[model samples]
Target: MENENWKNIRVPRVSSIEKCVAEFDITQLDVPSGRFRIRIYENTNGKFMGFTNLKIKNLFDGYPEGGVGNGNSITEALEDTIKNFMENLSENRILNDSDFIFVNYNEF
Candidate 1:
């Protein structure tokens, strides 16, 4: 029998991430909410070279959760953060600007 998992496989894209530019903490405003760390980096090398490094970390336990993203600007980076975050977020969880507070925004 032929393998069927090939249809579910996804090719990984090349990354150009060089270094982190800014990182800070943020708190979710909803009930049962938690804190998270947002790190932005500069992508200066590869076919996908860019200006922002999209990464986020769970502050509660220091485990990597949200996937990743890349952008050319801060706004784009944050948008990508939210998008990837929501995709990785648990079911029934809601995320929004007003519901998420930037705890340490001085870094940005």
Candidate 2:
């Protein structure tokens, strides 16, 4: 069967803000004009590996033109996004279940 998109995955790591941060990245993402930005924070919970907190910024400018823009390459964007996702999963559960899943979004 064709794989489903990640946005529809409904990540269950939203329990703690820290987990959310780990599941997403900001620096790696393009970061549109007025979109959410990914954020990774180092928490001292010491529950798992000390470091805690992670987030991904949503960058999506009005898709007047299209989804493809001139900023970061697909490899770079995917790398950062997947990095955050992996770290979060490792800390908790569901490690890279959607890593291979390619997801694309645009601002409307």
Residue 21 in model 1: shift from native, Å?
0.9
Residue 65, model 2, lDDT: 18
lDDT of 1 by residue, 1-108 (tens): 243333344457933234555565556543124656667665443111112122233546544344355677655676677566656554454544343333334443
Q: List pairs with backbone clashes in candidate 1.
A: none
CA error at residue 99 for candidate 2, angstroms: 16
Where in model 1 is the C-alpha error above 4 Å?
A: 1-17, 29-33, 45-64, 90-108
lDDT of 2 by residue, 1-108 (tens): 232232233457654322212323334232222233332332224122111122222224211111111113334433554454444334443223222222342211
